[model samples]
Target: MKKPSRDFWKDSAFALASVALAFAYGSLTWKRDLPNLFRIRAGRPLAEQAQEPNPSLKFTGARGRPLRPFLFTGRTFDVFYFDHVNQPTAEFARATLQATSFTYATLPFANFNQADFRGSYFERASLRGADLRASHFAFTNIIQSDLTGADLRDADLTSARILLTKLEGALFNENTKLPFSEAEAIARGMKRAK
Candidate 1:
């Protein structure tokens, strides 16, 4: 009121300085973690992302041609049939098979044990009697495929689409990770291996 006291000025200066320092410290501390928090939202570099192989390109045959379904069976095993007569033979055992378009491809009696076929598209493809034990087929599409008598023991089918696929007699075990429950698979005519 009367005259500004020296102590008043000193208190004002200290308050201003304290606010400035707090702001500076906040900015400095936030800068370190800002990039990590916003990198994904701000579109991170492609190199930093988990890249998947081009499916159509990876499952190609000689000269970059798309491969056909392959089939083989021993005398002890039952006969398996694939409808693709014009496509070339292809096997996918212990391999990472990625195919964007495998419609009408036949792979009856083929061995796919311990293979990774995640996100593969297998529409109308025949996988009858195929040995797919211990395979990873998460997010795969097997619509309209013939999987009759196929072995799916210990296979991972999380979020996989098997609509209209022939799963009759297909073998799944307790170790198999199906997208649906065991009751649903059994209702759909899928059998559990004894």
Candidate 2:
């Protein structure tokens, strides 16, 4: 049998090395970018992924409907229905949210400073640790909502109802207006502070 040429041996070794290099590069790229790829597919930027809640977990509404997207900023909401939707759940300092129904919506730690919420409804909504200072809640229905650890200084709650709402540990000042009397407000857990 004829011996293989030296050039053939060299060509085979070079091909083997190329294949190994290609495999290593492909694997490293995939491993490093897999999470980012999934985040992009879900239509969320990578920087915001860590800040938002886990997308795999879902929220079900009172009527068994899938939760809708009620999380936004600096935008107007007309007759909007805010249920248990959760995502980007904060930092709406200058928004104009006018929801018709905010029943059972969980908006904890949101920044609503200088925002306007006229003619909105927030029945049974959870707004713990929110910042509503210098904001407006005129003619809003905030019945049975949880406002624990919330800041309401300089806020206008005129004509806003807070029947059965939780305001324990919440901060309010003389500038914060409530439809109820001062005694009634304190009786319902709303506090006066500086």
Candidate 3:
């Protein structure tokens, strides 16, 4: 057989590779999850990725509260106190977390549907893919929380302190109340709010 040019093979290989990676994100599993995204985008410089490597937060203290699938809808939690959680499960979902300090706790994919989060300190907490619809975040401190893919549709985020946090793929509808600058900053991490 006659020899085909090397460039032809190279072009064919490149085309195949592009097609494979085109829908790559569809099946790709991002470790940043919902909450870690916050840390990735805002916590460190966007140019540097390998050094940070999805920073993991260590647990300081955790009060042995009952572990069950907690749910909160149409309720008010004020002046409540809870210790630092090493790692909280879905049990604490939607529970009135008023004045609660959940520093560095990984609650990825937890359900916080319609929960009241007034004065809650979720600094450096991971909440990727967590259901936060209709939740209250008035005066909450979500600084450095990983909110990569958390659903914030109709969720309140007025006056929340978020310095270095990832907000990629997070759902924030019109009803969501966040500082205009912060929203713009967060939109950069996700797929253009689409």
Number of the top TM-score candidate: 2
Candidates ranked by lDDT, best first? 2, 1, 3
Worst 10 residues of 2 by lDDT: 57-66
Ten residues in a row with the worst lDDT in model 3? 41-50
TM-score winner between candidates 2 and 3: 2
List model 2 lDDT by residue over 34-128, tens digit each. Answer: 53444222223323432445433112233423333434567554554545544334666777776445677777888898888888888888889
Candidate 2 clashing pairs, residues 3+ apart or interchain: none
Better of 1 and 2 by TM-score: 2
Looking at candidate 3, what is the lDDT of residue 183? 48
**Which runs of model 2 end up more than 4 angstroms from their true locations?**
1-71, 87-89
Residue-pair clashes per candidate: 0, 0, 11
lDDT of 3: 0.61
| Candidate 3 ranges with C-alpha deviation above 4 Å | 1-77, 80-94, 181-186, 191-194
Which residue pairs in model 1 clash with each other? none
Model 3 over residues 34-144: C-alpha lDDT tens digits? Answer: 333333222222123213333242112233333333333443444432323333445444567676566666767777887888878877788888888888888788787
Candidate 2 — what's its lDDT?
A: 0.69
